[model samples]
Target: MIDNNFKNEKAPRNLGLYIHIPFCRTKCLYCDFCSFVSRDEQQREAYVGALLREIEARGTKDYSVDTVYFGGGTPSLLSAEQIGRILGEIKESFNVSPDAEITLECNPMTVSDGDKYFKELRALGVNRLSLGVQSAVDGELKLIGRRHSFEDAKATFLAARGAGFENISVDLMLGIPSQTLDSLRASANQVIKLAADHISIYSLQLEEGTPLYRMRERYSLADDDTAADMYELVVKMMKDAGYRHYEISNFARGGRESKHNCKYWRLDEYLGLGLAAHSDFGGKRLENTRDMERYLGGEWLEAASDISNSEREFEFLMLGFRTADGISKSEFLARFGVGFDEKYGEKMEKFKKMGYFCEKGDALALTESGFEVSNAILTEILDFDY
Candidate 1:
């Protein structure tokens, strides 16, 4: 169905594929993602089958897939065989590049037999692993409803390495319940000791309707000021440890950034293939149905809207600012036929003078202080009617 809409494409483009697995063992207290806690193997198999069918129906040989990501409610929850089947279908349906960066998000607790499990995944062409090690503090982990302990995460990381995985990422969280500066430092130090290729540190956001939000009064969550202090400390620590703060929430060794994620920031075309997954492709924005029954019944599309030029411009600036590299002035002009300064220079000069913005060579990026209050700055600067 999607193929018919984009059949007149003129040239081949590189694509990133995102496959969502919306099943988890237990939902975290702060999670708002589209995931269900289900142990029904039949349901999992049925979901996989639907994904395979969608891949066949929408996939085109017109694009070369350079990155494939398995994200979700713990993608590693699926057995290696199931993951392999999905990857096999994708390869058969699309022109997947030989050196495509394949990444899978894993929960440490789900890796029952890490050695065998990770080895099988490696053999299936999955080259990167993103372990959900939310905190190295066992108490904090418990308070956050994480099933895996710090030890479990460490063991899983070691096992992934034993399975020949070189590109591994560990996730850490700030502003968890009962998180103090010392506890935050300990968590950061412990994850750093693992020497993972990438580390993603996120500030926990309390979403409405989540368990954490309802119990907000019960926990000693870090205040705004404390959270900002924690961020500053971690940035310095990561830089000292030779990791680049490549994005607002991501740190990585040189040349180890997540290729699939960069596609989103760069506004490159990517196709999402699962329930509640979203795709920005064929000059349109598409979202798959969130209802499980609708998804399993082969009614995939929930919404399809054309992305207007102005919307694209806003997104290019918004997403680009999330990265340390920011936006390229030349590329902006080349793509939109308008000079970046001609459009935004007047409004941004105040912030630049105040040390919130920086221009290095061709890149216009936000300073560290700018990232601190990026929301306020973006609100004021991205106010143009065009």
Candidate 2:
């Protein structure tokens, strides 16, 4: 049941919409996301139908959507019409902002007919494109089970440009099989030459049960120290190229940061739809079922939990520290009714002495080196026994 307070509130809250398209042409060796390669058109159509039904069932006028993100096993794998229908349903269900930042994640291999595909998406209101390029070296790409070559990625990017996309982001990986400093530099330089609006570089994590993890011994991966060096090098390169390091793993040109993703780090409200999607709204955390059969049959929710005040406080600090701006002292007090210094002053002083933490104006943030070992630092600092 919808909350009466939410429906009767004078001002509607800003919300973000995340639609998961769990379909892929081919799964990457290192991938563990909920996705599969399905050639059955009927099954895909059925999934889309289920999504439309869910949107209607959950639709509410109490929230205004400012961002819409289409993420998945290559969301571009869906037909343009299917993508349009999903967006259309969202608009019908919610008061989507006129200038909402709508983003879609695409794989180069899936958008081979890039010109037509991207043009259709552009016409359907997708203003941002996130291409999964991973690496620019063909050998590195092949080793990671990516089907497209670097050239193919470049062409896809250009095609999106030609189709009138001004905001495009590319994904890059740091530590991969046989990745060296020189090769990593080359890849970074190549991506920079593309002049993309945004870039997200992440270290490769070999998840358990993935092909790369199962055959981990077959490939040569970088050591922790070498991977750290590569990270520092990329940071310098991005700084020299005039990209702002807004978040731990993201860089953007002036005024081109990902608005949708920022909502997550800021702990803003958002609604996630589709198979295995997760949402945090109205002081509640919810996740959709990972089972495709259940999702297709309209079983949307897998689990739901009410967030405690302490958990919210810890999450605010944890997620806020992931960004370069860090957390605001006044804002923390306003939200939790307690001064941050009163709670974490001792820990902050210790970290400051170690040169790992600093206070800029009214906000407290971690240094670049601090971000490298943030997991340990945050674990120690936010270990409240409440």
Candidate 3:
């Protein structure tokens, strides 16, 4: 039965692809990304072969993919042959545009192997490299269980440049147990020195099972006040370095925003392939099993759900609030076939009255303070069933 509920809504699809590589050299303390700590080449080769098979088995990709991301266990850990094979699979499976922004997640230690890694990655058509250089200080790196040193990260950047990578993004974290303002700045400064095109400045999140979370039982981390200070410091430093804070945790130089992640922020559809991967396509949300065993045998899809109209609306408001440029008013109206002012008039009016939302032409954008308590503000706008 077709529901009339969202008959007024606009549905847009500019598709993207996410390929997951669930293998890692070591797991970090505050990390929870799906990756296994193993050097089993046999397992890796087998996984690559299976992934190729999966790619081959996929339904026809009718849309031209503008962005394709190879996220990790440590994609850099893969042999050149392995990386090439996967890219070949991608080429064979879908119509990836020639100028597509193909991004690969790499580790500092991985590229220390030199031209072999970078040359192969470039040859395979990856244009962007997101390097995980969590911290520059050795102490902070140790505390966070990161394998690369400040020096190693520099070496990795040098290697990438030597290998002819022009578009590179560096990942750094804030609010670690031993992290300080000076330490954090040093990390950022070193990364900026590399002249990376983009940077992902993430806060240290203590998940339930991670080592950092367990450390909470023994040592005190930076307090909320200090963490906030660290985040603000990062914002300032990155901005001063000529990077735009396009998204909360991301910054890019010039036009170097991450196309892959922007797809997520824009609420566009994507299909993820690998253990513990998630996919949102055709109004359906699906997640693959986190189990490697299940992935090997083809019993991998763990869950699927068609999102409710209410849920989609909630997502729209929540995600729109995350970007520097808040949701487009005309686009919002077009999507819902009604004035955004009509749907969330109370909240919009309330916020504008309170000076939280500023009228920006046809869009309603969050003021600095509005962005501060964005969750509370968005909650007021959404008609959540829960």
What are the models' TM-scores? 0.95, 0.95, 0.92
Write model 1 residue lDDT over 1-386, tens digit each, in one string.
11212222465578999999999999999999999997999999999999999999998998899999999988999999999999999999999999999999999889899999999999999999999998989988988889889999999999999999999999999999889889888999998899999999889999999999999998888888998999999998998999988888899996899999999998889999999999999889999999999999999999999987778888989999989999998778766778899999999999999999899999999998998888788888897443
Worst 10 residues of 3 by lDDT: 4-13
TM-score of model 1 (CA atoms): 0.95
Best by lDDT: 1
Considering lDDT, where higher is better, how would the candidates rank from best to worst? 1, 2, 3
The list of candidate 3 runs beyond 4 A from truth reads 1-13, 353-355, 383-386
Report the lDDT tens digits of candidate 2 across residue range 53-170: 9998888888889999999977888899999999999999999999999999999978758899999999999999999998999999999899999999999999999999999999
Which residue pairs in candidate 2 collide? none
* Model 2 weakest 10-residue run by lDDT: 1-10
Query: How far is 315's C-alpha from truth in model 1 (Å)?
Result: 0.8
